[model samples]
Target: MTTGQIAIIVLILLGAGFMLISAIGIVRLPDVFSRMHAAGKASTVGISCLLLGAGFFFLDEFLFYRMIVLIALIFATAPISTTALARAVYNNEPALRRQLRHDEMAGSVAEAISAPPADGDDAILTTPS
Candidate 1:
């Protein structure tokens, strides 16, 4: 096989390996936050690598650009979405709060949870009005 083919295979295998580890982490983790962390970080990298391999294999300018865009989107959105989901889950689920050891967001999240909803707003994390 050509060097390029070998490189493509390596990227695919690396991506698949990361995905496999992420799947295992999601299944084995004890909490929703941990599982989300695993799914978010590892899957983003795995999908990016897989897309890169596919882009190389196709060698079409249009498709390659699309693949790059997809990778960028995944990298850009995964962490933000993960953080939002974590915050939402933490605010909604009291049991999850007890599992935290450090509680870095304690002050902010606690304030948000306890603060009374503003006029026409019922969300837990409310903005100052």
Candidate 2:
């Protein structure tokens, strides 16, 4: 086989391996946060490598560009979505929050949780005298 073909195979295999590891992590991990972390980081790399391999296989300009865009979008959004999900889970699940060994968001989360919900009568939206 050609070197290009070999490289594509390697990329695809590596991507599959990463995705498999991510799946294992999600299943084996003790907590929701760890599982989400595994799913977020490993799956991003896995999907990117898979897309790269596909782009190489097709070697079409349009497909190549689309692959690049897909990789970029995954990299851009994965962490953001993961963090948002984690925060949502943490805020909603007290038991999950207790499982955290080191939480940088503890202060902010505590304050947010303790803070009273704002009503529509707040001065921020009202005209000042």
Candidate 3:
């Protein structure tokens, strides 16, 4: 009924909507990469929004700081975890690329790790080859 209550309701609805959409995306997407993109990215946003809404509803200064810190931590580490999971999945299935739209880290990391230039094989000495 009140304005503040209305705002909290709207924020919660938006967050829940994003989470539901992301869940659908994971289930309906054609491939693993697309599913990861949806679930990983959208869920992070949804959770942040939910926390933000809860912060306002709780109406406490300390709680607000805690909410902000939680959101910050989510923003900080989520992408790294998502990338690591994606890379793990990709290593086991090279064919993942065929279904993906545009893979920025397609070959470089894997190639660099799989076969490094040997010291004796390449013989790329600083002084002489």
Candidate 4:
């Protein structure tokens, strides 16, 4: 096999390994936050690597550009979405709060939760007006 072929195989294997680890992490983690952390980080990397390998294997300009765009999108959005999901889950679930070792957003979350409604309605709105 050519060197390019070998490199593609190696990258694919590495990507698959990362994805497998992500799956294991989702199953083994104690809480939703930890599982989201594992899935988000690992899946982003794994998918990027897999796309990179496919680009190399195809060796086409169009595919390479597409792969780069996809990788960039994943890198840009994954963490933000993960953090948002974690924050929402953290705020909604009281049980999960006890499992946290350190919560940097604790003050803000508590303030948001406890603050009275601006519109004098019973339902509190977390979103800024």
**Top candidate (lDDT):** 1
Greater TM-score among 3 and 4 belongs to 4
What TM-score does candidate 4 reach?
0.82
TM values, all candidates:
0.83, 0.81, 0.78, 0.82
- Least accurate 10 contiguous residues by lDDT in model 1: 120-129
Instruction: Give me candidate 2's TM-score against the actual structure.
Output: 0.81
Candidate order by decreasing TM-score:
1, 4, 2, 3
lDDT minimum window of 10 residues, candidate 3: 120-129
Predictions in order: lDDT: 0.83, 0.81, 0.78, 0.81
Tens-digit per-residue lDDT, 42-110, candidate 4:
998899889999999999999999999999998998888887897677666666775668666655654
Residue-wise lDDT of candidate 3 within 1-129, one digit each (tens)?
999999999988889999999999999998887899999988988998899899999989999999999999999999998988886666556566545566665545445345534554332111110
* Residue 108 in candidate 3, Cα distance off native in Å: 3.8
Cα lDDT tens digits, model 2, 1-129, are 999999999999999999999999999998888889888989999999999999999999999999999999888888898888876786666666656677676556545554433663332222111
As a whole number from 0 to 100, the lDDT of residue 114 in candidate 4 is 61
- Give the Å shift of residue 110 in candidate 1: 4.1
Per-residue error (Å), model 1, residue 124: 9.3
TM-score of 3: 0.78
